[model samples]
Target: MTLSLFSQFSSPSLLGIPLIIAALTLPWLLLSLPSGRWLNSRMTTLHEWFIARFTNQLFLPLSIKGHKWAPLFASLMLFLFSLNMLGLLPYTFTPTTQLSLNLAIAIPLWLATVLIGLRNQPTHTFGHFLPEGTPTLLIPVLIIIENISLIIRPIALGVRLTANLTAGHLLIHLVSSAVFTLLPSMTSIAVLTAILLFLLTLLEVAVAMIQAYVFVLLLSLYLQENC
Candidate 1:
C-alpha cells in the first residue's frame, strides 16, 4: 500500500498521474464556463454527433435539453464511467482505482455539492447540514457529527474504489499463481488457470461498473439534497 502510494505521486507533473486527474476534471471546467447554455445548443449537438461517429458512444442516451449543466455533466460521468470500466480489460490499468485519483475526483465533487447548495439556498446553506427538526439540546452534537460525516464522504469514496480494485486484482493474481504452482509443467492446468483468470476478469468488470455507479449515485444524491 505504501509503495503504491509513493508510485502514484512520484510523477509530480500533470502529464502522468495528474493527467488522470485532469481527464476527470477538464469536463467540469468546460461545463462551468457556459452557464449550462452552450452545451445544449445545436452546435454542441452536432459536435457530439460527429464525435460519436468516431469515438465510442459514451454520452447519455436520453435527451438533455435546456439544462445547461446536463450535457457537460453527462459527458464527465460517461468519461469517468468508461475509464473505470476499462480497467477490467486485460493488461489495462484503471486510473480511478487508485486512492489518489479517486480522491482527486471526489474532493471536487464534495466542494461542488457545498457550493451548489450554498448558491441555491444561501440562507439555508448551513441549515442543510442539519436536519430541519431536531431537539435544541442535540443541535450542536448533530451539527458536529453531520459535518464530520460530510467531510468523510470523499475519503470514503477514495478508499472504497482503491480497496475494491486492488483486492480483486490481488485475488485473481493469487489464484493464478496457485494454479501455476500446482501444475508447473501441465498445459492443461495452465489453460484452466487462464480460463479462471478470464472469468474473474469479467467479474471484476462488473464490480468496476458497480463502483463507478455507486460513486455517481452518491454524488447525485448529494447534489439533489443540496439543490
Candidate 2:
C-alpha cells in the first residue's frame, strides 16, 4: 500500500532507457495538426483560439523586441499544460514532478534571458544589480542581495513547480487510499470521503493547469525584463 503511493513517482524504465522521454513526447502527439485547406476542424479552431489568447496575454507586457519570444513561450505553455493534465490520469507518472526535469527546462531559459540582457544592453543589465537610490552605505549589501536573487530565479522556478505538483499528488494519493480503506469497514464515511475526493480531484485539475501557466508566465516576465 505504501509502495503504491510512493511508487507512482518512481521513474519508469525499460532495458536501461527511461520511459520519461516517451511521456514528454506523448503530449505533443495529441495536439491538433495544422491543415492546408481554408477551413479547419473544430479541434484545430479551438487550438488556434487558445494559442492566440495565451500569446496575447503572455506577451502583452513585454517590449517590441520580446515579440520574437511568442512562438517559444506559446509552445512551452501548451507543452507544460498537457504534461500537467496528463499526469492526473491513473498509472501515469508526471515528468514535471521531477525537480531535475523542471530545472533542466528552467536553467537554460533563465540563462538565455540574462544573456540577452547583458548582450543587448550591457550597462543597463549590470545597473540592475544596484538600484538608483542614494544610499552610499547600503550599496554593497544591496548589490549582493540583488545578485543572489538573480542567480536564484531558475532554482526557484524549478522548486516551485516540483513542490506544488508533489504536494497535490501526495494529497490525492492519501485521500484515495482512505476512500478505499474505509469502503469495507465504514461505508457511510467512505461515501463522504468519496465525495470529498471527487471535489479534490477537480481542484487538483485546476491546480495542474494553473501551475503550468504560472511556470510559463514567469518565464515570459523574465524575458520581458531582459527585452
Candidate 3:
C-alpha cells in the first residue's frame, strides 16, 4: 500500500534500464517536424506558428544579444511543457518532479546566464551585489544579503518546480485512492470525490502548462537581466 501510494514518483525501470531515458526522449519524437515540401500539413503549420509566437513573446523584452538564445529558450520551453503535460497521463513518470533532474536543468542554464553576464560585462554583473545610495554600515550587510539571494535563484527554481508537481501528484493520488476506497461502500460520497478528482485533474493540467511556462519565463527574465 505504501509503495503503491508513493510509486508515482519512483523512476520506472525495465530489467536494469531506467525508463526515464525513454520519457525524456519521447516528447521530442512526438513533436511533428516540418518536411521539405512546399506545402505544410495543418498540424505542422500550427506547430510552427505556436513556436514562432512563443519565441516572439518571450524574447520581445530582451536586447539583440539575447535574441540569439531564442532557439534554446523555445526548445527548452517546449521540452518542459511536453514533459509536464505528458506526465499527467496514467502510468507515466514526471521527470520534473525529481529534484535532481530539476536542479540539473536549472543550474546549468542559470550558470550560463550568469557566466554570460560576467564574461560580457563583469563590472555590471558585480555591481548587482551592491546597490547605489547605501549607507556605510549597511553596505556589508546588504551585500551579503544580495549575494545570498543571487546564489539562491537556481535552487529556488528547482525547488519551486519539484514542490508544486510533487504536491499536486500526491493530492491526486490520495484523492483517487479515497474515491476507490469509498466507492465500494459509500456511493454518494464516492461520487462527490470523483467529481472533485475531475476538477483537480483539470487544475493539474493547467498547473502542468503554467509551471513549464513559468520556468522558461524566469530563465528568460534572468537572461534579460544579464543581457
Candidate 4:
C-alpha cells in the first residue's frame, strides 16, 4: 500500500516515450498568444493584466539593471504556475514533483545570479563570504559556512518544491483511498472523510500556487542581490 501510494510520483510513459516530456511542454502549447487586434478577448485581457501586475510587483524592488530579467522571470513563474495547477487534475502527472526536474530549473537560474554577481561585482560577490567586524579566529569558519550556505541554495529550492508537491499528493491519495474503503461499511464516516478530502484538495490547490510563486520570488531576490 505504501509503495502504491508513492508509485504515483513515477514518470508515466506510453510506447517507450516518457509522458513527462508532454507534461512539461503541453502548458506552453496550450497558452494563447496575443492577437494583433484593436480589441482583445476577455481572457486575453485578464491574462495581460495579470502578467503586467506580476511583472510590476516582481521588479519593483530590483534596480534598473535587474529590470531586464522581467520577461524571463515572468515566463518562468507562469510556466511553473501552470504546471502546478494542471497537475491537480485527475490522471495527470506533475513533472515538478520530481526532484530532478526541479533541480534542473533551479540550478541554472541560481548559478546565473551567482555568475552575474561575479562578473559585474567581483569584490561585492566575494565579500558576501565574510562579513565585516569578524574576529580573525572565526573568519575562516564563517567563510566556509557561508560558502556551504551559498551552495545549498539551489538544492534547497529543488527539495522544497519537490517535497511540498509530493507530500500534498500523497496525503490526498491516502485520504481518498480511505474514503473508498470506508464507503463499504460506514456510510457516515465515509461521507465525513469525503468532506475532509474536498477541503484538503482545496488546500493542495493553494499550496501548488504558493510554491510556484515562492520559487520565482526567491530567484528574483537572488537577482536583486547580484544586480
| Model 2 lDDT per residue over 153-184, tens place | 99999999999998899999899989999999
Cα lDDT listed for each candidate: 0.66, 0.92, 0.92, 0.94
In order of appearance, the predictions have TM-scores of 0.65, 0.96, 0.96, 0.98
Q: Which prediction has the highest lDDT against the true structure? A: 4
Off by over 4 Å in 2: 1-4
User: Of 1 and 2, which scores higher on lDDT?
Assistant: 2
Error of 4 at 216 (Å): 0.3
Model 2 weakest 10-residue run by lDDT: 1-10
Candidate 2's TM-score reads: 0.96
If the candidates were sorted by their TM-score against the true structure, best first, what order would they fall in? 4, 3, 2, 1
Best by TM-score: 4
Writing each residue's lDDT as its tens digit, candidate 4 over 1-227 gives: 77898889999999999999999999898777899999998878887898899999999999999999988998998899999999999999999999999999999999999999999999999999998899999999999999999999999999999999999999999999999999999999999999999999999999998999999999999999999
TM-score for predicted model 4 compared with the true structure? 0.98
lDDT by residue (tens digit), candidate 1, 1-227: 55743343232344344455554554344432224663566655755664464223332332232133454445555566677665555555567656887798889987887787778777777875678879899999998998898899889978987888777877776777767776768878778888888899888878876776677656666666666
lDDT of 4 at 83: 98
- Name the regions of candidate 3 deviating beyond 4 angstroms: 1-4
Clashing pairs in 3: none
